[model samples]
Target: MYSKFLILLLLSAFCTSCGSKPETTRPVTGTITESVYASGVIKGENQYQVYSTVNGLVEKVLVSEGDLVKKGTPVIQLVGKVAMLNTENAGLAAAYSRISANGERLSELENNISLARQKMNNDASLFERQKNLWDQKIGTRLEYEQRELAYSNAVNAFETAKLRYNEALKQLRFQEQQSQKNLQILQTSAKDYIIKSESEGQVYDILKKAGEMVTPQTAIAIIGDASRFLIELQIDEYDIAKIKIGQKILVNMDSYRGTTFEAKVSRVIPYMNERSKSFTIEAVFVKAPQTLYPNLTCEANIVISHKEKALTIPRDYLLDGGYVLLQKEKKQKVSTGLMDYQRVEILGGLKGDENLIKPQ
Candidate 1:
């Protein structure tokens, strides 16, 4: 009986030793902020890629990276040999088809018309004289009939000459007008070879080099406002609905380590990126860094809510389904409020001084 009793005592002590004390924490009064995390890059205001409107060999890169530019400034010149040749050919055609250049042809038609008019007049006078003589019974009938036939032929010839002159004039005028329009079109197309800046800003990058072939699909350079910058962030679709314009943002960048910058959400893109399943948002700096560049990487937290002096405990102290363990290993449910990475605010079911055990 004593042996069995000693075995029982030893088993009790072993069981007690195996059951370790659970870790514990008490609710504290402090500030807690609820925020949504986002990752993004810094971009210059109005940044965009420059593309050529026409395909050609890059004749020269007119502006280098980091150069200040004005609106309508020529940035890149393309080799436009073919376009130039076409323009020149069009100009030649225009000049050759001008009314002045074809004046000799028109003048020849006019002279024919004038000569036909004189012949018609002379034949009519002869026919009138022959008729008078015939009526007075002094001329043969054959002579009067021949004069009448000659006058009729002369009148027909005159009308045909006038018609030929008018048709020739109309054809010449049409040729001149068509050639002018073609020349204008070719000249406008030739100007496309010179790529110009669409905005006044700094040149961030020159993507194409001299002697490189570029198409309308290829980017020629990068340009944007040099003095202003903004943050472009991608928020997860799950958290996107929580985001709103004018929300406060805390920004951190690898380039500027150990510093957090203040910013505000300026815009939210309504559309979500299907491939990434994220929504894009933009923010402007409240107090910007002195020096900034386009495409600098950054991460940000958008503040959703904040509470000052709320009863809070470490996040690990709360178990699944908002339950916490008491000193006697009793489970108590708590209402939650604002939460951060480290702490969560307790809204109910826990007093300010309760000792809560962390979840195993």
Candidate 2:
């Protein structure tokens, strides 16, 4: 009986000692760096859908997929009646000068005027000499009359030649203006025969094949420099307030396994979509990989609120808002502050050394 009594006494002492010692629990401490995580898909900085501005049958494709193209580079050629008509009209107008040459015609008119003036000068000389003789009574009236008549005929011929030269100048100017107008029309028509790139980029897709009929609004090929990447994430409405612009973020891509990337919140859109009950958030990577492709799936974490030295407790220990069983003895209500998904801030009713915790 004494041995049994001693054993009971020893066990009692051990129990008392164990109860007096501080209990081991899961540590609940304030987090210095708060974070929120989300998953989304990677996208390009700019996307383009190329289309044709003129309607025709696709004749030729100058670029294939992955080909680098410059602004205003020809992408495709359209074959149709309109293209043929433009080529024919330009040829006809360019060759129109062959039928009637204005410069040659002008030269001919000038030569005729020169001959007429020479005849007028010769006749005048004869008429002057006769007039002088008539004044001196040394020439007969019939001879003077014949010379004057000849001079009058030469003057009429010279006047007619001058009029013809002026008409030729007018015709030459009119023909030059007409030719320029026709040339402009032909140039405009030629532009419709080919589609050109509006931006410098890589051809990502070819929507139309050669010999396919297309319209002005037809999307032919997509060309864009999709090298740089960004992420578009949809955040829930309940968590929108915790997110802000310029917040630091962490990213993980499905393609890059066991590798993580960093990014920042560039924009936090204010409006929430009714269908999604979420807001769109955009982020840019800090150091993007060269192999990052567009439409790649990615996850993001946006750090929100952080605390370092404040009182905190495990989330599972609390019975309700601001309520917890202290040291397995008494229940007390307390005020709280900032909360995370794992822990809650204990603002009042608990000391740092006080035992108010539970098992993990």
Candidate 3:
């Protein structure tokens, strides 16, 4: 009888302890997402380093660092003494004058050709009259031969005159071409003295100072459009597969304390860094702050996957190996697809109406 009473007490204690475990709440309907958190730096899209295209002394620096500039604005002025001197000493003026003189000479050649044509016509009339007299047997053949020789000489002179006229036209064309080419060189020299901006942007740096001798390809200034900015982040090798273009992102910059901005993934670089074993990704802000600056450090959360209006449970309920104890009754094994830092996506094995529990 004593042994039976001990067994009954132990059984009752075991049942009471089983009933004492607390109940856990399951999420009913909300969006569940998988995300990755990372750090990044802000940069502009239109950043470029400006360089000079001609060798000269920097006569003036019209823009200082941090000055806003527009397209075609003169950022620097250079004086090319050799180039200017060459232009002044060259035969450009003489070439233009020669082209004008060639035009007048071509007109004179045309007049000479007209006079040769008139002489040829008169000689041909005389030769035809002498031919008619010889055919009628009333004039000597020598007279006809002399008139024919005169006509032939007239024809030769006319042909020579036409050839000279055509030659003069060709010379005129050649002179025009030479003059135009020279004028173009002079125009280029005038424009080369001024260094113009290629785009509308802010001047971020000035590499050359006034009176500095700069050659073609020497960096003059750094300019970029500051209005557009993006965050460049590196994803670890383990988490790179979870990032994709067009993913929604939450960004927080260290400069904007306690504030966050919405952004979207714009690019995912295909290649990975061999040394760091990471891949780079870029995100563009949906609502950018007015005070954003380049190289600003930012933290980003990349949302990889999502579930809409589905059942979810607190992440703490997951046990070792992603198993969960449900209502302290059954061990539910779930297949996960995506997860945030706290919550994970349940792919299968859990019914929408099942109960969940938190492990102590």
Candidate 4:
């Protein structure tokens, strides 16, 4: 009797413990995504820092901040007296070569040519009369020889005058063309003194004031196509390789707090920034926000992979060797696929209905 009672008590205690064991949650099907974190800024299409091409004093600023301008619109005027003077001198030289070249010097050559022809005519007549006299034996040989020598000298003089005229005309014409070319070069240089917008946009800011000495490297203003905007991202070197053009980006902007926007990577600048150790990426809005401004701070997640329905569990529930604790403290290994910060996808070795224990 005593042995039977001891056996009953042990059996009742074991059954109570089994009946009171805690329940566990089952794995559920859900969406999972793998992504990389990135930070960036909003910018307009063709956005850029404006700079002058020449170093000079800012003579005048033509456009104010937020002023709308057209392409080829003058933004800043620089003072360059030397450039203007060079243009003026070139113009004067071109005019001299074209107009004054045919003026006095050419006229003198023309007159000289005419005079030489007339003298040659007179000398030829004398020479012919003397030759006839000699042939008839009516004059001394010395007289005929002297007339022939005079005619030869006249012919040489006329030819020399004609050659000189042609040479002078060529020289003057060449000078005119060269001077005109020099004028054009000087005019182009003068244009550098006036900074113009390359695209139509509003001036975001002006960095120079009147009387300030500015260099070609100095920023004068900011401009872009205001109606269009894109995101400029600076991704760390380690993450750049995984990023590619056309990747979907999940964006969060500082300006638009609590709101998430969507964008697609448009460009990935190939070279790494040696100093910053980062790479640049460009993205355009898929469904842009209602509005955007230049240089707005933003954060983005470059999606690498995603699944609409996946077997997922809290990342903390996964242990070393890809094992998961199940009901009754059972352990099973699982293969993982896409994973994010909070959860990981189980590709195999687990079913959706299996109860999983919350990690202690």
Of the pair 2 and 3, which is ahead by TM-score? 3
Which residue ranges in model 1 land beyond 4 Å of their true spot?
A: 1-17, 109-170, 326-333, 351-353
Tens-place lDDT digits, model 3, residues 265-331: 9999899999999999888889899876767888988877777855566777778887878764678
Worst 10 residues of 1 by lDDT: 351-360
TM-score computed on alpha carbons, candidate 3: 0.67
Q: Per-prediction count of colliding residue pairs?
A: 0, 0, 0, 0
Give a tens-digit lDDT track for model 1, residues 43-149. 98999999988889999888989999999899999999899999999999999999899989999999999999999999999999999999999889999999999
Clashes of 3: 0
All models, RMSD in angstroms: 5.0, 11.8, 9.1, 8.2
TM-score (C-alpha) between model 4 and the true structure: 0.81
lDDT of 2 by residue, 1-360 (tens): 999999999999999987885433433555644567687877766657777767788889888987888899988888857666766776676556432555677778889999999999999999999999999998799999999999999999999999989976776667666776777777777786788888887787788899898787778887777476778888988888888888888888879989888898988878899998988898998888768666688887787867787777767777665677766557868787766677777778766566665533
Per-model TM-score on C-alpha atoms: 0.80, 0.56, 0.67, 0.81
Who wins the lDDT comparison? 1
lDDT for residue 264 in candidate 4, whole number 0-100: 91
**Tens-digit lDDT track for model 4 on 116-172?**
999999999999999999999989999999999999999999999999999999899
Global local distance difference test of model 1: 0.94
lDDT of 4: 0.90
